[model samples]
Target: MNKLTKSVLALAATTLSFGVFADVEREFSETYNFSSNGTVRVENINGNIKLEGWDRDQIQLEYTASADDKDDLERIEVEIDASSSHFSVDVEFKKKSSWFGGWNGSSGEVEFRLKVPHEVVLKMIDSVNGNVAISDVYGDIKAETVNGKVKIENAGSDVSVDTVNGDVKIVMQQFKGDQRIKSESVNGDIEVYLPENEGFRLDAETLNGDLSNDFGIEVEEGKYVGADMEGRYKSGNARLLFDTVNGDIEVRKD
Candidate 1:
């Protein structure tokens, strides 16, 4: 082939290769109509998930598909189920990428963010390898992460958060009725912030770390040789339990 023809073929090959190996990034946003007492449930494999409460009577969600290879990004599905009294948004894979598309170290990740009505009755967020955060939410919050942090802030209801390999932090803006908080972590710290005037009893325990607080509650050594603290504040109507295996437990007055 002539030199000009050789150059043209090389250019075409390069373009084709680029197209085959390009990274993929895409965003999806959706809004679904729903009445009060909505419930959102999420399960994320490897990305952050955030939840925020809003005043509107709808569930709004946005998610991003990111992968080092274009085809790897196509395996994720944002599943949504909206009913008059219940709603759910889930991150699911069309097929498990571990078997089909995980060859040659292709990286894939997805992040989900949602906003729902403040009167939603129940909310559940779960992530395997990424952080989970919720803010300004009402009702009951149940959040968990296996390898990342769980942070719930400015919440106005009961909360239960658990993490195996990361920290857990909860900041309660106020107490609604008889609020209950139960948080646990296996390998990281657990911190809870409570309203100053709220009456509650704390049952904080740690197996390998210190149990601490700024509320001046005395730390009582467990009968089995661990750190356990139990005390009441004022009326002690509310209840809290912070448990950790290899990290500290701290209770702070907000």
Candidate 2:
């Protein structure tokens, strides 16, 4: 065979190898020193984001990337911006920033697991195609995602969450001096659980679903062409407002 024919055969073999190993996976983990009131923010364009607060003074982060194309795993950049009391994380790829939720199944995916200080703050965590979950945290938190679920449990302070095509669930341990909580979604449910004795101003609405109040409060219907409810829980001063387009909304006690 000629040299040109041999080169073509070699190219075919290389292509076949890449196809066979398309599902490449990569893992990364790191730890950084952090303190109270510190912030950890993430701008992820794919997969899930999970964060938990601990008592330690350091922050731990672990991420995994999987893709059908090997280069898709290799092209992801986890950029960190840190300061004395805050840290920022940005995940980058070749696609547009709005591609965070509009990618097809053939694209690569990334999942993040973070351990932050129990008293640290969490800024807006933006994502498109993955779920966002946080538990045992004690500060202000703002998270938004599209086409995924958002769950915040055992919150120690205020929280604001927004999502599209997913559910929003939050459990508050205590209220902090009129702290405001807001959650909104386009195609999912919004569930809030609060303490028994805390006073809360409840404002909730759903377009295509019902509002259930297990807190002994009444929800009036036909408020705005759908289910809507507003009331004062007890004698407290905190506020909570939530709305959804195609799912149920519930407020209950802990």
Candidate 3:
């Protein structure tokens, strides 16, 4: 063979080596007719979940599932059930045994991005090993995660968030009625932002961490190794609660 032929073969070999390590990915996109007052639910594992609110009367979902092995990528499945009033998306993983007979670990990661009606309620957004984020939403929201952060912005209604090993942050654009807000973390910080002149009853506590706020509520040091604050602002009709085991808590004015 000529020198040029040898160089071409070498380049092809290099490209094939790189391809061997590249991850396999699958993409999905779907749209459903939905109502403004509908409910949305999502269940995922091992990847991030992001949601945004829009003015359109529909739900748009886009997701990507990736893995190192093509077989593992095939094991990841997205199950979606939708209607005019309710929408649900669940990420399911099929189990397989390893060479030694033990069950293999997670199939892959599934990242989700969704756009829903502005006034739809997020009844549940649960994840086992990924972050959950929401923005520009005006209905009640509930989210929980085992090992990832949870964040919300431009919220206009009640909120409930919890995480086992990640931080939590919430920004309230406006409070609706006497809505209740609660957040808790096992090993991460918690921060909440609200209007400067909003009225609410605040109850915040932290174990093995400090407490700070922009609401002027007195942070009382615990007897041993933590701090807490409980007070009311203005009308104090709305209730807010925050707790953490091994992190700080902050209530900020927007």
Poorly placed runs, candidate 2 (over 4 Å): 1-22, 95-106
lDDT of 1 by residue, 4-26 (tens): 11111112222212235576666
TM-score winner between candidates 1 and 3: 3
Alpha-carbon local distance difference test for all models: 0.76, 0.79, 0.84
Model 3 lDDT, full chain set: 0.84
Order candidates by TM-score, high to low. Answer: 3, 1, 2
Best by lDDT, which number? 3
Encode model 3's per-residue lDDT on 1-254: one tens digit a residue.
11111111112222211135587677666677788999999999889999999989999988777777677776776777777788888877878888999797655788999999999999999999999999988899999999999999987788899999999999887777788899999999998889987798999998888898887789999787878899998885788999999989988888
Find the 10 residues in a row with the least total lDDT in model 1: 1-10
Which stretches in model 3 have alpha-carbon errors above 4 Å? 1-20
Cα shift from native, residue 36, model 2 (Å): 1.4
RMSD of each: 10.7, 10.1, 10.5
> How would you order the candidates by lDDT, starting with the best?
3, 2, 1
RMSD of 2: 10.1
